[model samples]
Target: MRFLPRIVTFFLLLPSYAWTQTMHNKRYNVLLICVDDLMPELGCYGNSIVKSPYIDSLAARSAVFTKHYVTVPTCGASRYSLLRSTLPRTKAALGNEAAKILSDPETAIGNEPETFIEQYRRNGYHTVGIGKISHSPDGYRYPYAGPKSDQRELPRSWDEVSFNPGKWGHGWNAFFAYADGESRITMQGEVPPYEAADVPDEGYPDGLTAALAVDKLKMLARQEKPFFMGVGFFKPHLPFNAPQQYWDLYDAGHLPLTAVPNIPANINLASLHNSAEFNQYRLGEESAALDQPLSDGYARKLIHGYYACISYVDAQVGKVLQALEETGLADRTVVVLWSDHGWHLGDYRVWGKHTLFDRALRSVLMIKTPAMSRCKVVNRITSTIDIGPTLLELCDLPPLSQADGRSLIPLLNDVQDKAWADVAYSYYNHGISMVTPQFRLTRYFRKEQPVIELYDHATDPLETRNIAERSPDIIRQLTPLWERGNTGVYAK
Candidate 1:
């Protein structure tokens, strides 16, 4: 090598390393907010009916992702994919039992694939998980009808994982709880799927969770080390229970039902299912059928309940954001709000998220970092799994070598980037969906009555028409992209 001055040689040899060091020294705090079963029904997503003012405000300060998706449509698998920064590597990762399956020491990759939160904790950041930061709603193990287990969902990730079930006592109980400490478990099938109780925010479990998170923020603010605080909110998911005030924000009669409530034309009806998840509440007025539309009155009521829960969760998020500002941590923190997966409100005649439909796969994702000032919408395709690598890169951490997602920092820096991935992938059991910029292609790995459905997003944004039979060239173009998503159990 040619001889040069010490300073000049050092700069020439380590420009990228020096930048990473400087960024690492900044010690930016990370606020990861995970909302459960939230659809893109916010005011920012151009739905004027939903009263999501706080999240909308956050969107104004953040790079809003209009085409973001998850790797799985169901909650546990979707969250598992997001946290692990990988595609579902096994069949168990595709179910609600993902915590037990993916975190088990015997079968998990390297005795549980290292979580991004665990990486943050290892990097000397104090990691805190408030509610359902993992597969479980309260970050603890629980049977569907029993008390909670002593086992933590991600045993080695958090410096502190705390939740206040209040009078509901445990996680699953609080999951279907209402105001005044009453949960569905104690109500004996008498309680309805939705409730608008006349009480304060603390009347519901999410309200209590918000209060706990605020207190945690205050505690984290006093700490000397940078923190990775994951605040998970359980709302708008099921049993759409909120304080009556949030319900008062909406007019039931004015709220519109889904325009495309029937099965898509020429698509397999097997792709859609009855609203079994919604009907499980035991007191629902009517069970959603694959053949029949929900009653107009019941549909309005469901919409009202859904919006109420969204507003309620929005208020809780507002409190946390307010705390961030008050603690003087806003400037030093990177705030990201994401939903596990999207839910359906009578779309394709489905009331819950189970299908490989775009309504279930596409979700809400927004990231606000200290480096970005002007808010923009990133229309480029992205996935929730990309979140892990993005956070790692932003914090100057080492790359996750096994991660399936690419860092979205490029899009964050320039929202109009054209060289981004043109497709997003989502999976449900045996079915796989690939969402390209202008189309959605789904394939079910079935030996009997195999299904390959395609929807052209250019003209049918609602995915009401399956054009696979009419468009052979498009199918040929997108088939490779669809097959590339066949990881885990679906892989050949």
Candidate 2:
């Protein structure tokens, strides 16, 4: 009314429109929690021995994916696949693709003009990451809008805390410094005398991770802006350390035996390049004597240690969930819990991850959305790649053009009759594994030589027998499916 200048009037109208746009584009906050080298040992997954109270409760509120599988078994490869929503084989073929895509200003993975995090950021959400969200060390490459720091090491990225004492590297009571051909194990921390409170599960790094996550969540909730926080826990991996109390929970004598008596003679030497990594954890005569056969007692002890570690990690998970609820972000936030890949605790006579075995490839995927009516469990074969697209959908962001995975919103919403494919594909250095609802087929191709392994999971859930040599017709039928690299025809 006061005859304001035209430019001034335009500027005056801009703020209201911007405010409206911000409100209109508000996206759901995401809390992505990842664990390293964890298997499906939680109570929700039907593991009676492992005590995962927090995850079990979280599963009660979320849609638990019973048949979720990682695209790769290794840490670096699996993390890359999940973050990019690309098949592991595709990523492997495009070696260094992750670095290339992230560095490209024009087409960053998950930062394209319409990428999920970019869209959320544009809509005024704060994106922050903690711990090992990226394949790179020190949380190097993520869309973190805030401080980034490696709490574990120097040359920190953004912001970091100090490492928790007595809880590093799987919480092993003994510390080993790798030097020359010989390794020495010395007691780094005191194992409390057989007391009720001195369990190994209580002393693991996962507990530290959980405490840090809880603290971070509390701090973040004070800010007005909604946030996407990634909290990663490193545990149940190696060094097999837990509180002595956890060790006391199970008698080594009563622990389960290894599935195999010894390493299979049929496994080629080339397939065992990283054998030392697994060998480092073997106990008793095999570990002490190096080349000697593993004793039954030592194998049982290793298994017992592994179960204790899982329970320890599970307790840490409970702490984070409690923090989320306490901070009042539980209702508005979308919570996604995943493991990079499964681990092998004496399955197939292999002691670590890196193979295409089901014990190493299958992981846990649990998604809790604010929109879901109740807890549901989907047993369909799903790949880790689907996680990226699912997060995009949850944030109300358009799927990235380069994303090979389809959104799993339909599945979460109880649309069971929707058509989908049976096969979920994974890959390693030179091996390819294709898993269907009832079968797992692995094909190894190296130097033009072909080797095949197949397991009917329905009949042999432990994968103790290989039926590939006996079933040529089944192999022929499934080989093409693996070659196609498509789960099934779905809308892009």
Candidate 3:
């Protein structure tokens, strides 16, 4: 009788043991690097002025997404969408949604409410979030009552670092401090001295976050556990503060200027939300010289500053990558570097990203996988939503019901049997922009009125000429496509 029981137990345990072994072999690690307020202006993206060697190198090793667009333009809204893999209706709605989730967890939005980090945790992968992974820190806290509403309700997935406390706009060499309620004049290109204990760009919140990530990589290597690490960098967004060396690299005399003409008189200012606020900041620049023709020289200087911040962020990325390589995690790790949304350096007569312009909506996305060859650039149109499903596929995890993204695995594997097209959508305030491989169509909606703008991206990459009136049929063809909601895998 004892021998019979042992035989039965051995037979039963075989399947479970085989399953465990399969799961272990299929597990893959993920490293998600997110930058704040960055646009697709890196050297890999063909910008000559910005010096982002780390990102450039990463680009060489990954699939460079040339037409990746975010669902929103602002930081909080855009990051929320990327985290959730869903687009917000408008800027105000997005902000309010974030506020509600942070204020009262029970009332958070989204029907399918699970974060990718949580999913990775469910699959036995260790997860860590550093820096600005969540829109605001408070969002991570519980609701004081029942089950928490935010996707982070799954607590086991993340381990966050302490918030680095510091002055808001200290690092950048900009002339004005948007810090206080009232703007004040500050010296431009002035690099303040710092103590050895003082934080460097990498040592600050972003740098500390990256350092913690590197440590986690090391720990994971020892344990042989697959990890999903999210390292968020907060720079090049506002204050534009970088080390003195970075600021010195850009000569204001040769900076490139913005080239947006005056807003047409026929357009209503009310159509664009928060136009007055944008103009207020521009007027505050106190540059009598900018009143004349916009010059690329001045624009190049701002570009240089933006690039310095990017390079600063890139160095942190290199740290994480180095740790991955040293830990022998590089071969199995799937690295994805992305920005929340594009930044506007005086494009469309706007200094920031609150509008539905390409400069404001586009982002840089690079993905490196063990399955793909190096230096491959995919010029297809994709969205932030695709990130969720793609990571899930990479980890061999089952797709979540709430995820509205599609897996880019087929695209990554270079499977010619599959056919894909470039199609991305972006929204800000009340405006929505649909980007095809060759065309960008924007529809600005109001309470009772709507305006449409179309640009042939192949010819008018800058979006200077609006051909909406000239191409009515094309507008008609694309409007219906925009109307279809949740067209991704989750919808099916």
- lDDT by residue (1-492, candidate 2, tens digit) is 011001111111111111111124446678888887888876677665566767777777677787888887887667767766877444432232343345444543342532344445655677665656655333443222213332221111123322232322321211221111112233321221111235333343455556777888888889878787777766666656666656666777766564543433334434323445555444423542223334666666677767766666677777888888898977678889999888766554556777777778888898887654345767788998888888877667767677778777767654363576756888775667889988988776665333677888877666666688788999998878887664321212
What order do candidates take by TM-score, descending? 1, 3, 2
The number of the candidate with the highest lDDT is 1
**For residue 282, what is the lDDT in candidate 2?**
40
Ten contiguous residues with the weakest lDDT in model 3? 1-10
**TM-score of candidate 1 relative to the true fold:** 0.93
Off by over 4 Å in 1: 1-24, 111-113, 447-450
Error of 1 at 466 (Å): 0.9
* lDDT against the true structure, each candidate: 0.82, 0.61, 0.60
Evaluated with TM-score, which candidate comes out highest?
Answer: 1
- Candidate 3 is scored at a TM of 0.77
lDDT tens digits, residue span 385-450, model 3:
888888887778877676656777656655231476567777665666788867877776555343
Return the candidate ranking by lDDT, descending.
Answer: 1, 2, 3
